[model samples]
Target: MTKVRNVGGKITETTKGNDNSFAKENITYNSQKKISFTSDKGIKHGKPETLPPPELPSKCKVEFRPSKSWQGEFGFDWCRIGDSQLPVDKPYSDIVGKYGAIYATSPSAVFTIKPELYQRHLAEYEKFVLSAFGTYYVPNLSLMKGEIAVLDAAIEIKENPDSMYYKYDKTVFEVKILEKLSNTKGKHFNDKVLEIKCLKEFSSKQKIELIATKNKIDNKIGQINVLPNNKVKEIDILFIPVEHNGSSGTIKGKEITILTNALKQAYVKGNIVRHKEKIKVGGWWYDLFFTKKDDKGVVSMETSNIRSIHRALDDVFFKEKDNEIYKNHYRVYMLTNSTSLNGMAEDIGKNAKVVVVYNNRNDSTAPHELMHAMGLYHTFDNDGLFTYKFQNTDNIMDYTHQVGKDRFSTNTWQWKILN
Candidate 1:
């Protein structure tokens, strides 16, 4: 076992059984991006592998992939890569020492982190944090479900009083000190003063939680929770993104900024919609890039005719399905100009080319359209395979997002048919 302690601001790990030299290298792992090792001291990993395709019920379907972006000669470009993580409907260790340092060199390292899926990973959260808090959660409930962001995060520098932060997946400062690892749970969690720092202000936004606390807590911040275990099976999503038609260029500056934050916020809203039992639908990870480039085959068009949009996307996505993109990736688009349709994803569409969307749409656009591409018929549509008489209009499949209570959930009867 390796003991992790903070030597000043640097993280130091001391091991007992094998060679303890892996901790001495100058390695950097950003909480927002991913945990990686430099070539000098890390184990040699084969080329990254992606998650297998999802097997949807004969009645419904979904898949996984990641959006890998890099700078190219033509400004910015993107492609698909293997999704790094997925949500497991199980409990995790709360021991802070049971986190990242021990398996620092291993590829299967797991940390109970609080992750935020940042728009373009390196993008700071000053504006987004302020806006979202102002819009949805200023003086909100004291304790709520923490699984809104796409992935997890950890602050390597605990002492730096920065104005921004990467999203944390598991840690809970309750907006104050992280006492979970210092002592036992009873004493740490009982302090109401910590929880009341709820709306504490930072440079531009109110902090939801602090990264780590001082003293013997080891300065490590990660939390993992075992849920109410009502689940029997699991399905993983390798959520991938692809762009076409110079789609990212449609909006500039604030248009992009506001829309980008809205999409991320929408994604957080989408995360709340899940099948907690029998089937746990999860696709929590995504990537947004600083540069927006189109896929080679995606045609640039101006009009919003749904069929024309689908055709332009289908031809390129289908033609290059094997290499540049995959059938599992959910393709996203943006255009120089758009019309009445906020976004579009075809119904009961089997292939990847079957579903596509313009990202510059409203905040409520994604999960609904994504479900269509994933083989779910609208609840009100007569062609659905299962009979579902929803008692209310809060279903995600319906166009009821204006109320902000729509959920991507189904009735017990619908669950039975699909499960």
Candidate 2:
């Protein structure tokens, strides 16, 4: 049987087969055009991005780069490299040319940004999500791990008239690549290791200059930045367009920030451990199924006496065998345009998967509702009254927002559900 659903400005169609298999298709719309792509597992396309990248660069050179997936194949989820968690429903400002970077969305396919949506994505969106760095995912221009980045005409070799036999010893293409973040695997790639291939080929003039300076006075990229997971991120690499083509012939350009996917943490309240890792999470499989949008959508708990958004979601999250799907990991069912993120839990004896809704507006309620699924409750439900105490101010399950505090801390006693 085939079922169609429309929610959150997107359309999802699911089909179940006689053999008990499932296939889902998602359709999203843009005002000017519609862009679509596929993935092995469904993605939560429009979640708010709260985690930010490191302040410094993670430059790894050819010798130090990892051998597993150098080209960001695995979890390199930065927007520039490819799989950024950019919200799809936002307005894309198209302000650039046709030649933009096309990155791998899957091993078999890559997502290419249409030219109209180029600069808006590369410039504005990149900046909005980043405090520093411009989007530098352009191929050849965007150097990956193990890729040697050099300023073509940005830095011109100048003559050092004071030094004998060192005519054009001034810094050039190599100096920037050695120090600047061509790749940020989080190591300092700039101690100036000679690219083995060309060392012997250096003329006596270059050799004399190299031996004189050694490592004393070369370009400096300062220190490397590491992410929350204790690994240097490639997306944090920064490369300036300073060509030693000539001293006076320098070109003006913006800093191209490399992008990588990393999870962010809320340090004060470590309860949200999911986003604490700097490394991207892969295969922690979960799907976001949407219930049809309604004028009323899902009722707001603040206004409504009682609403069973969870039960509504469980009814349609999947029509086929429910136990088979949500057995291992719980599923998130979004009630698009809903005013509430609250939902009920798996009803007793229903064997249904726990369903959680996304408040298309305020997302603060998600973690709280998930806490319910993890077996938490209001401070107390005694006498049918939701309990409140000064201690409950930090509890995610409490109505702490009423006290003008947006808190996520949970008392140790309430966290026993995880064990």
Candidate 3:
């Protein structure tokens, strides 16, 4: 039988009937009697005694030590690599030893750490600390679910692809910290302070600015200001489906596909295509979500009676919670089987826009509601009583009951407002 020896608090073992080296490097074993090597000196085992924890350094260090022990509950809230943080769900051990020697441990996994491992960990850990103290975190990595950006640490040295690389992923972010904004129980966590701007649904003006910046980058312009031209661009549409009884307005059967095709057809039928072959592919790319229902599986439509239904869904489903992170996407609701008015598009709060339409509409409904979302008002003037002008039937914003072919003609002011 092999006897176990205690070298300080570290446990070591030797092979039976063999006086030689241990299975682990740097450890020595003996046969007739158990012996362990400490710093190339053989030492015999005695009664195990617990030693006091090692003292922590005033500042972090990089060199490894052999004689000293380490103390304190050193752990990291997150681990940053390149511009992204590894999705470590649990608190990770970040033990610091004498002379600031560091070692990181995880509850679920182990890493074959090199001598320089702690150096990288320390660098990333410093970024996390800065973010915890409220630093700007601009990440180049795509974010995960329930995660939000915290801060980024600037690196003086430029990274080379071959030497500095993550083994698992293609690219590693320099440093980024992120935290779950809400827990599984749907409770908000204020301590996880992170800011990310790209996920926001930008306005048309903001989108123009983004396009201008991209143009500046592409053209390699040293000193220039970019301005967007007056051309219709593709818009992102997040289609939140609110069905009363598995049907929207009056349209039933395959909500997403049918509605998508109908919307496409409406735009195509309106003769908005740029050319024959250069058809707009992402003219209205969408992400769909079903309406929230009660325990009885019935969707309540009464705004007065079922306010919670609206409130809960509105609170949860938004651009901020978007997993795909679409830029400048508009959140519109396709509320089905409504017994009320046809459709409405208005602002809910500051910088918040919502467009809702019932299902009983034709192909033109989606475009009409979309025009409202894009800042277009009805053709009929509504000073007190709605008065229809001669141009009302000639425009897409005209009332549905009007008697003429509707075109997508907008005045100069209207176009300026839309863009």
Global CA lDDT computed for model 3: 0.32
Candidate 2 Cα deviation (angstroms), residue 45: 69
Off by over 4 Å in 1: 1-305, 317-325, 349-353, 385-392, 402-419
CA shift of 142, model 1, Å? 23
* Candidate whose lDDT is highest: 3
Give the worst 10-residue stretch by lDDT in candidate 1.
70-79
Cα-based lDDT at residue 352, candidate 1: 34
Candidate 2: how large is its RMSD?
29.8
Candidate 2: tens digits of C-alpha lDDT, residues 1-419: 56776578865667674322222444445667756656577855474544443332311111212122122211211122212222111122221122213312123422232554443334321221111232222211112223332211111112121211121223322333333223322322333322211112121212111211212343211211111222222111111111111211111121001011101111011111111111111121111222234576732223242235444433433344633433344444433233443444443223333544433423335445544554555542321112232222334554655545443434323322322
Overall lDDT per candidate, in order of appearance: 0.30, 0.28, 0.32
Q: Write the per-residue lDDT of candidate 3 for residues 238-318, one digit (tens) a residue.
A: 556543333433333443333333232222112221111111111112112223366888543443333233334344444
Cα deviation of 330 in candidate 2 (Å)? 1.8
Order of quality (TM-score)? 3, 1, 2
Instruction: Count clashing residue pairs per candidate.
Output: 16, 19, 19
lDDT of 1 by residue, 1-419 (tens): 56665555656666676643233335455576567555467686464443322221121001111111110001110111112121111111111112333332234644342223212221211111221112111111111223221112211221322232223322332343222222222212121122221122122212342233333232213222211112222222222234332223132233322222222222211122111111111122011111222576433333334555455544544554353433344444433334335666754556433444444555435545655665556554445542122212333454444444323333222222222
Give the range of the ten consecutive residues with the poorest summed lDDT in model 3.
64-73
What are the RMSD figures for all models against the true structure? Answer: 23.4, 29.8, 25.4
Q: Which of the two, 2 or 3, has more TM-score?
A: 3
